[model samples]
Target chain A: MMKDEFLKKLRSHLVKIPEKEKQEILSDYVEHFQHGFHKGRTEEEMVRTLGDPRKIARELIADYHLERAQENQSFVSLFRATFTFLGLGFFNLVFMLGPLIIVLSVIFSMYVTSLILLITPLFAIEALLMESSLLEFLLRLLTSLIGAGVGLLLGMGTVRFSRTFFGWFIRYLKSNLNIIKGVNKHA
Target chain B: MNVQFKKGVLTLCVLVLTLKKDRYGYELVDHISEKFLIAEGTIYPILRRLTKDGYFTTYLSESKEGPPRKYYQLTEAGKLYAEELIGEWETFNKGVDQLIKEGLDHDEG
Candidate 1:
């Protein structure tokens, strides 16, 4: 392939990237071609040496999404990065989805449990009001209030754990990506 | 001969190359390709990544040949990173050498 053809293919594959960044990426290849020409090489020769444009674009896109996920730390970018890896191959589906499903379920259950515990006082309100004995009413209210306090603490703990888990999940994804990239094969 | 293995080392090579002097994308590719084969175009993504990571700062310089060139200079953090990688590489290299020697001797025996 000549330089123009190669760059054209690369540009098409890079539709996901923003215009400015995409242009910058293409310019790098254009500069590469110029360098090759200066070294007395043909465009076809340069293309052959550069390997496949598709693979190059894949790496660029993956890197871009990964960076975005890391920076924004939003669910949208994280899911986008995860799906991008999933698109890379079938193996990623198992690796990416397994932990994702497991962690999310665990977090969901924790939140549910905490919410139930927090609402215990509401559930006990009628029982406390109907009790004619003051001591029994006080006992019920005390137990209910304790449950609510524990619920609050558990909710706070879950939030902290989720934040830490978020950081950890990102790191895990990064290291997983490095392994797939084969950059960490020796390390 | 593994592509991934070469890629992992390519980052180290790029770091070490720019340790002494700033180098352009093509120049870096040329120097490394002379030692081992690589898809020349792949180096650009690596360059882009390292630059984005802030390990290297780049500037455009006018070349005598065609158009201006983008030259990569190692940042202070890049130097520290390169040194750390070099250390890990040396230890890893030693372990691999030992394993190879032992395997060869066992085969001969």
Candidate 2:
């Protein structure tokens, strides 16, 4: 294939990356082609040795998303990074899917528990209107207040914990992707 | 021959290549591919990543034959990184060699 066709295919396959980065990535190939041409190599030879443009784009896209995930540590970004890295090959599915489900389930359960604790005070409001004795009412309110306070603390801790956990998770995914990419002979 | 194992080594090779002097993208690819038989395109991403990771710094310089090319130079951190990887490679190499010798002796016995 011609250099232009090869690069155009690569550029089309790249998604979710900034235009500036897209240009920068393409320029590397442009420079490579120029160097090869100067060395008396044909464009076809260059393209063949470079392997598939689609495979190359997969690597770049995975790297870009992984870097973004590392930078922001947001659930959305980390999810995107993980999904993109998983796209590299099937081995990732075996390695990442089980851990991913367990991690998300653990986080989800923590959030639900915190929410349940936080709403205990609302339940105490119903208890207050049920004509309970003043002492009983006061005790119920005091316990509910304590529950809400603990909930608030737990909520904050979960947020902090999830952010740090996501950071480490992204790093693991990055190294995992690196290992898979190495095993990818076509890449 | 094991691509999975070679992947980490590829990073080491790139780091070691730039240790003595700065080299351009194509020049580095050419040198390593001559030895490793890798997909020529993959090396570019590795170069970008190593540079991003602060192991290398890049600059654009003109060439006599064509447009200017980007050159990668090792940082102090890069040198230290190369040293660490080299040390690991030596230990790993010795371990593998000893295992091979033991396996061969066992088969003969």
Candidate 3:
């Protein structure tokens, strides 16, 4: 019966406040009621001191508006932070990827150049030593293939990390949206 | 008085008063009660109905003593509505006055 009265009063209070603010006021009062009960105040005494339900509802409605205004100001700040974090993360990925691509390209080019340099010398040495030029050329080509495979692995690793970071950020945004919807439904 | 009739007129009165300025629920009750012998409980349901209808909006202001009071104010639509009601009331009063005067004159004759 008391719970019903409390909910009735609470709904009356909510009518004066905006939907978003109403939940906040309800939670605050619920907490206060719990704390007061713990302090050994009898339910009847507590309700009496709280005064008429209609009157208390009026007061809570006023406080709800004030609190809502404060929350809106903070919401603007949080919005800025969210955008800033996303921007910084995006730029950080760009910075890391740019250097990674450039380094990989440079290393691959150097490996190709070194292979060309080594092959010419190797063929010349094979010719001078009367070894088979074709055998020597084939041996140097296999070593160059191994070097290119290692470079490809390193490049793939950099791309993998970049993708992972973006995926995590998208997941975070989706979860945050879900949380907002849940709160709205509850309100 | 019939509950429906009282409710309709009281709602109209509240809308008219709130058009001038915001008034606390209790103050509204007291103001109307001074003129009509209506129960305090009656005003609350009317106020809620008016609020739901968009004729009135409510807010709370802090009181020096005790809890804050809920104040009701008329919206723009409510003001327009009140003006039309006021015009109709004036016409009805004038007609009633004329009828009463004629009746008194006939009685004298």
Candidate 4:
């Protein structure tokens, strides 16, 4: 491929960085191609030697955003990190995305379960007002209290679990960053 | 070399190579790629990271044949970092070697 076409392909694949930095990176490649040409190499040889522009961009983008996400722990940085990881390869699609969705669902369901449990006592009181027997009312109250107690415990567990999950995910993504950078063969 | 092992070693290699003399992007790429079956672009990200971390500083110099080229020079921090990393690798390498020797001695017995 020609220099312009290669640079265009690379730019298309790169996620946004600041414009000046983007220029700096592209200029480095431009220098590479320029030097190769001066050394009597063909554009095809230069491009081939450089390897896949998309894959290179993917590695840089994923590693950069993931590092930022780790340092900042901001939602925006994490969203960028996850999105860039999805662009990486089939491995990330299956391993990263699958677990991310599963963990989110688990967290969500735990929250719903806790809310339902905590509200049960209120509903039981309403049921007693509708002419239920004293024994039935007492039973409902007792069961509702037990349900709420379990719910509170589960709710607290969910909080702790979420923190642990977030930490593990950060470490997992950090290692995955190594794979993207060709530091690790597999993550 | 294993890719994981090479990644760490490559950083050290780059530092050692540039300790006294600055090297350009293609120069560094060619030097390392000659020994390892690496994609030439792999070293660029490492260079960028090291530069970002203040281990290396970059400058552009014009050549007679073409456009300017960017060169990487190790900084004071980079030199210190190289020393620390090299020291750690030596300790780790000796420990691994000793363990391997012990295992071989047992196998002979």
Top TM-score prediction, candidate number: 2
* Candidate 2, DockQ score (0 to 1): 0.43
Q: What's the candidate order when arranged by decreasing TM-score?
A: 2, 1, 4, 3
Candidate 2: regions farther than 4 A off: A90-93, A126-134, A177-187, B1-3, B103-109
Per-candidate TM-scores read: 0.80, 0.85, 0.37, 0.61
Q: Give fnat of each prediction, in order.
A: 0.45, 0.45, 0.00, 0.31
- How well is each residue in B8-95 modelled by candidate 2, as lDDT tens digits? 6788888888888899999888999988688899888878877887889999998776768899999998899789777766766676
lDDT of 4 at A61: 83
Tell me how far the alpha carbon of residue A184 in candidate 1 is from the true structure, in angstroms, after superposition: 9.3
**Model 1: docking quality category:** acceptable
Query: Which DockQ-derived CAPRI band holds candidate 2?
Result: acceptable
The clash numbers for all candidates, in the given order, read 1, 0, 0, 0
DockQ of the candidate models in sequence? 0.46, 0.43, 0.01, 0.26
- The fnat score for candidate 3 comes to 0.00
Best by lDDT: 2
Q: Candidate 1, after superposition: displacement of residue B8 in Å?
A: 1.6
Among all windows of 10 consecutive residues in model 2 chain A, the one with the lowest summed lDDT is A178-187
lDDT of each: 0.79, 0.80, 0.53, 0.76
RMSD per candidate (Å) reads: 4.0, 4.2, 22.6, 6.9
Clashing pairs in 4: none
Residue-level error in angstroms, candidate 4, position A97: 9.2
Going through the candidates in order, what is chain B's TM-score? 0.90, 0.89, 0.85, 0.83
